[model samples]
Target: MGDRWHVEVDRSVCIGSAQCTHLAPAAFRLDAAMQSHAREPEGEADEKVLEAAEGCPVEAITITLVGSGEAVFPPEE
Candidate 1:
């Protein structure tokens, strides 16, 4: 829990891999439509959230720090 993070799953890009859920169950879950949804944005550790984002093969997960709106996982470079 390094900082408050906002985790967003791009439904258009999510391919039902459920990798995010496996990496950080508390932060993500698949809906009935098989789209990944952010369950508890604050439930998982910051590192886990980052891992979930990095593990997404489709790169659907986008994590931003609260207040600052800084993209932490993707590394906007």
Candidate 2:
């Protein structure tokens, strides 16, 4: 079994960049407003998901551990 992750997109900071969708199609999608959204807020941790978060132009995507709430993408500063 793999670790679970919680994915989130900050719409307010998001710039409708399709980078995430392009990077992780199975994990992200764009709505009518062109805002990025997580296909699965909580799901098995995946390399593509991490890639998507890293590719987000505005750094709007955030990923964290499902159980411990530990930051995954941006990491703790």
Candidate 3:
């Protein structure tokens, strides 16, 4: 996809699982506290990033279109 996306990791909901990091090391990272964070808040849409969000056990990872602000993961209901 050529579109851009915005990624976020809800630290409060993250459990230091590192699933995001494991799935998309280029898109996600874990601090010393093990809390997950988006490597780039906004970047080109990537399949690995989506995979990381989908694989998150707590669903802490959220992704949306950068310009449209449309939900990309956990899709709009």
Query: Which candidate number maximizes TM-score?
Result: 2
Shift in Å, residue 42, candidate 3: 0.6
Best by lDDT: 2
Residue 39 alpha-carbon offset, candidate 3, angstroms: 0.9
Q: Please, what is the TM-score per model?
A: 0.87, 0.97, 0.95
Q: Please give the RMSD to the true structure for each candidate, in Å.
A: 1.9, 0.6, 1.1
C-alpha lDDT score of every prediction, in listed order: 0.83, 0.95, 0.92
Clashing residue pairs in all predictions, respectively, total 0, 0, 0
Which of the two, 1 or 3, has more lDDT? 3
- Per-residue accuracy of model 3 over 1-77 as CA lDDT, tens digit each: 59999999898999999988888998888999989999889999899999999999999999999888899998999
- Candidate 1 residue 27 Cα shift, in angstroms, is 1.2
Q: Which ranges in model 1 have alpha carbons more than 4 Å from their true place?
A: 42-45
Model 3: which ten-residue window has the lowest total lDDT? Answer: 1-10
Using TM-score as the measure, what is the rank order of every candidate, best first? 2, 3, 1
Candidate 3 residue pairs that clash: none
Tens-digit lDDT track for model 1 on 1-77? Answer: 35687888889999999998999887788999988998865433477778889999999988888878887878889
